[model samples]
Target chain A: MKDHAGARLIKDMIFKCAVCLFAFISLLPLYLILYYITKNGIMVINWDFLFSLPRPIGESGGGVFNAIIGTVMLIILSCIMSIPCGIAAGIYLSENKKGKLSNTIRLCVIVLQGTPSIVIGIIAYLWVVAPLKTFSALSGGIALSIMMLPVIIKTTEETLKLIPYHLKEASLALGVPYHRTILKVILPSGISGILTGILLSVARITGETAPLLFTAFGNQFMNMNILKPIDSLPYRIFYYAMSPYPEWHSFAWGASFILVVLTLALNLFARGISVKWKIQF
Target chain B: MTDRTMLKERFVKWVLITFALSSLLFLFLIFVFILAEGLPLFLKVGLKKIIFGFKWAPTKGYFGIFPMIVSSFLVTFGALVIGAPLGLSCAIYLSEYSGKKTKMFLKPALELLAGIPSVVYGFLGVIYIVPLVRNYLGGSGFSLISTSLILGVMILPTIISISFDAITTVPKTYREASAAMGATKWQTIYKVILPSAKSGILASFILGMGRAIGETMAVIMIAGNALKIPTSILDPLRTLTGNIALELAYATGDHRLGLFSTGIVLMVIIMALNYLANFGIKRKPAK
Candidate 1:
């Protein structure tokens, strides 16, 4: 009995140690990648790097200004396109409670969410670029809007559902119309959550390259035309990192750092809003 | 009741309903487009050739997906082997052992893991993991093993959070009863608590499998983009996502359609696993 108990204790100790070791190993890559990007990648991140446009192969003077501009454009366009549609869909799903139509819509959202971004890129290519005979910000924005839609809708629906039913009931008991109750009470309550979803979508769409690859068809310089080819941070990072030019490789790392920071900032901001909003409640 | 108020309420409901219908319609259009574009390739080439053909050269008019499919499965399996246990254990530790402070810190940290972009993970795989694998495992530059390790880490957050929710849901009454019967703490956990959470854990595993199978960017960056079936852990292999990402840019006609078919295959696998999770949820024993 002593022997068996001793063996079991040893086995338990071994298992705990193994788990700890595995957790450390899992974290190693994120550490290494972040370290490299900050170490070598930070050197190139200067005012010039941020302000100037991307130069041709082997040129070291220019920056990722065009890509940054283009990313903002894409995010704005995507948000504008997705917000109302996503919020309304989310509201409908949450309020309907249960039905065949609602279940089908829910499943459709899930399936759309599961579809790969690359496939979305391809279809967007066929839909927008092929017919228009141009690769543009509008195309990239629409592709990203599709990607953003399910995320926002799912999050918004969840947030609205989280709002207590009693609140809506109270407003209705006050003789308020349903629309006034929703607009004045429910939507105000859910605004932070809706914003959280939109911020996440913006952050996600900013870093995406595959969808933009087929839609934006990456350019080197800034162009304001929504109908013209545009540069984005992810595409620039992809193009520069793989190119034979040494200077371009450095630029790729810098672009990556900027992109990461932008995403992290958006994420942190959304988290802060959610936390503050929760505390208020 | 006021007529204007009734009209406004009806308008709001109708507008919301229309929005929902439009979203559903748009999703249906995507499916239709995928089927319209992808189904024809299978018809033209026959399912056998695409499924069984060994070669994947588009220029040569040959489009075999066997190797890519096999590699995707292998990587996902390897990742599960590495990730699932650690994740489950982490969940167990968090739920059963940790104090409030630790739980508070760890929960958010775990969630942050899932929020990190796939591209960043891919970058890590290339610069850090690939080299580490090359050094320890003696690979050329990159390998299936490296990709699996990175993906395993990436999926850890999903598994841990879900499993944690599951394990936490196991009632205190069971634990109290087992303790009253003179069962050791460890015994109660292993024999009673875990068994009760079996369905939830299984569902978590299925979700992890879905994430692993659908993953693209990280695997593409480290999987070496080779088409051959790997004989060893260190052997380079290419996945369906890797193939599409690398070659989709220049592909035309039949080749492009082949890529879409690969997407279909990926979706089918994921949907099947999702269904498995749904089944597990439905099969859970009533309290």
Candidate 2:
């Protein structure tokens, strides 16, 4: 019995050690990525990189002003197309849980969520770019909006579903109109979750390059037109990193650092807001 | 209630319904547009040749995607091999072994990992993993091995988070009973908790595989995008998603159609995997 106990204890110790080792090994990639990006990217992030346009070949001082603006523009454009309808569709899902329409809508969201970003980009290209005869930020926005819709719709539905049914009933009992009750009472109660979803969707798309590869097509000069092709941070990283020039590679690294910072900040902020501001009722 | 209030409520319901219908309309339109663009390829080239043909020289009038199909499966399988063990270990640690502080730290860390963009992961593969593979292991650093490693790391959060939740949900009574029977913690975990949570863990594995199959930019950066079927782990290869992203920029005529057809194939594969995962989820332990 004593020998058996010793063998069992030794086996348990070995298993625990192996699990701990493997668990830390899984985190190795995250550390390597953060270390490499910060090391290579921090040197090039002065004001000029943030505010000025890329320079012509052989000129050493140009910035990625165009890409930064374009990224923000794309985010805004996608949000405009996605948010209101995402909330309404979510409301429909929550209110009509057992209907065939809701089931179909739920299936659509799942399918869309699983669809590859590049696939979405291609369809967006065929739909908007081919029809318009040009690659444009609008097309990029459309592609991104499609990606955003699933996250927003699911988040909104789950959040609103958790709100006490009595709250909705109480609002109706007080003579609030049906629309007002939904729009004012239930929506407000779930604002933290809704906002967190929107922020997370934004963060997800902010570093997206594949979807924007064809639709945005990318640009070199500073331009604001929705119909024109625009440079985004991810697109710029892809283009520059693929280029042979050492200077271009440095620009890619700097852009990557900014992109990483942008995404991480958005993610952390979304979580913070969701946890801190969620109404307890 | 006033008539105006009643009328306004009805109008608002219509508006919400319209919005809801529009959401479904978007999904419908995506299928329609993809099919409209891609279906002609099959009619023009026949399904067998496009799907089974080994060569994909579009300019020379050939568009076989058999190699890409093979590459997609090979890399995804390799990723699961590398990732699943590490991911499961992490999930076990988080759900069973960790102190409160470690769990808190690790949970947010995984989210940060997921938040890192695919492009950056690709960039990292280019600069970091590729060099290591080339210098130490052999071949051009850009090969099946490098792509699989990058993908393995990329899918860890998905596997860890899902399985962690699954393992955590196993009834506390199961653990107590196993301990009462004189089982060690490891034995109890393997016999009771893991079996109870197997469906969820399987669901996570399936979802991670879906992610690996669909990943494009990272594979493109590391996989060398060769058009041939790789006979070894160090060989470079193209995948369905990579093929579309690589050629769509300049492809026109039948080549463009070919890429769209590739998209259709990709969507079907992903949706099928998702269906499988959902089946697993539906069968999850109620307790």
Candidate 3:
């Protein structure tokens, strides 16, 4: 061990450098992805492209107002359907931690969470589109809400679990009703964490193209009706990027840029809230 | 007021329980409805043929999906080959070599990489990876190798962050003991730290495999989506997920059922992967 000390030291140094070198190389994709998206998409974005409706294939110069509205509506609708149920479900799991029922529910959530997005799209089509006889925003919202449930439920449950039992016990001792204590006291304390989870889940679905492909279908013009088919950033990107026309390809690039921005902002915003607004308790 | 409180508590508890149970319901419904829609194809074509049949032509009444099955698992294996080592090296770099400031900067940079939508990765693959592979390697840009390379990048964040978590859990005393025994730092890491964190790292790779298999739009674009089974990494091929997404829009009759069956197979494989990962994570290193 002592005779070849210098050689051993040199070998370690070389190995360390190799590790660092390869690690740095692994991150090149992130830089390449961000730079390429910006390079290809930046020139395509302008007020006209952002605000106005897209022109038909032959005509030039339009916007993705429909996709923006569609993305917003899908987010809102999914949030409405998922947040309350997910939080409530989360509360149930945390509150009833030891039971066959809770155990089974947790397993199912894991399975659902792991299920592929394309498979979820098929389920949405069969459950909502097939039965309703049309592709609409309602089905898309349902699909996204299904995707959101496991995330929200797991995050909320984990967050709630970390709260000291004394807090709940103190509320019960004060003669506060169980429902009131949970709804008002326990939930408020974990609000930031729950909100963070919600934001991250929204960000996850924002770029989802498969589920909405058959569920929301796509629309060319502005739409607000929840029952009607709608457009979203990802769907728009897919439609235009696949088109043979160069102009449409540019639209796809612009939409891709918009999507990357939206998801990245949401993720950073979630991280910020979790870091800055977390309750010390 | 006391009676009303009791009633309200009971009501709320029941409501929450119902919501909690809904996840199971969703899973059950997906399985049942998908099976219901898909069983017809199996019955019409026979289970053996549906699963093992080589041909996937629909208009001619053939519904074999053997090729897609190979492509799905093969692509995931290829991604694992590309991603697992790179991700592990990066995880070791961040966890062991870097200081707190570097860790803080690099960790979330990885998360941001994960947060980028899959389709954007597909777009990147189509424009960037495809051309490079075509120009350099002498095949169509859209090939199994290109898909694997891009999917490898997509799965990197998953593998790296989880493996980082795993590596950090190795006891500090183990490293100290190794160093005291005249071991080099590299020797200590390879001999002690990695062996201890094996389960966790294995779990991370399993989850990464699931993500790679489940990916659709990204695979659809850069995979070339050919129906044939790939003879080499340079050949274009379609995954099971790709097949469903590509044909479901216009498929009717037994064709639609076959697509649903394809979904069923995809879900089952993913579930099996999740099951293995769950076991891997749950069995922690002995204290």
The prediction achieving the highest lDDT against the true structure is: 2
DockQ for all models: 0.48, 0.81, 0.81
Question: Candidate 1: deviation at residue B207, Å?
Answer: 1.8
Q: Which model is ahead, 1 or 2, in terms of DockQ?
A: 2
Q: lDDT tens digits, residues B83-149, model 1?
A: 8977887887788777899788777667666766777677656666777888877977578788778
Give the TM-score of each candidate: 0.93, 0.98, 0.98
lDDT of 2 by residue, B79-131 (tens): 99999999999999998899999999989999899999999999888887898
Residue B223 C-alpha lDDT in model 2: 95
Tens digit of per-residue lDDT, candidate 1, span A101-176: 9999998888777667877776787678768878888999989999999989998999999999899999999988
For each candidate in the order shown, give its overall lDDT on alpha carbons. 0.81, 0.92, 0.90
Worst 10 residues of 1 chain A by lDDT: A22-31
lDDT of 2 by residue, A1-281 (tens): 99999899898889999999999999888898999999999998899889999998888878889999999999999999999989898898888889888899998888888888999999889988888988999999999999999999999999989999999999999989998999899999999999999999999999989889889999999989999999999999988887778898899899999999999999999999998997679
Q: Give the clashing residue pairs of candidate 2, or none.
A: none
- Model 2 C-alpha RMSD vs. true structure (Å) is 1.1
CA displacement after TM-score superposition, residue B40 of candidate 3 (Å): 3.0
Candidate 2 residues lying further than 4 Å off, grouped into runs, are: none
Report the C-alpha lDDT of model 3 over B118-144, residue by residue, as the tens digit: 888888787778989999997897899
How many Å off is the CA of B173 in candidate 2?
A: 0.6
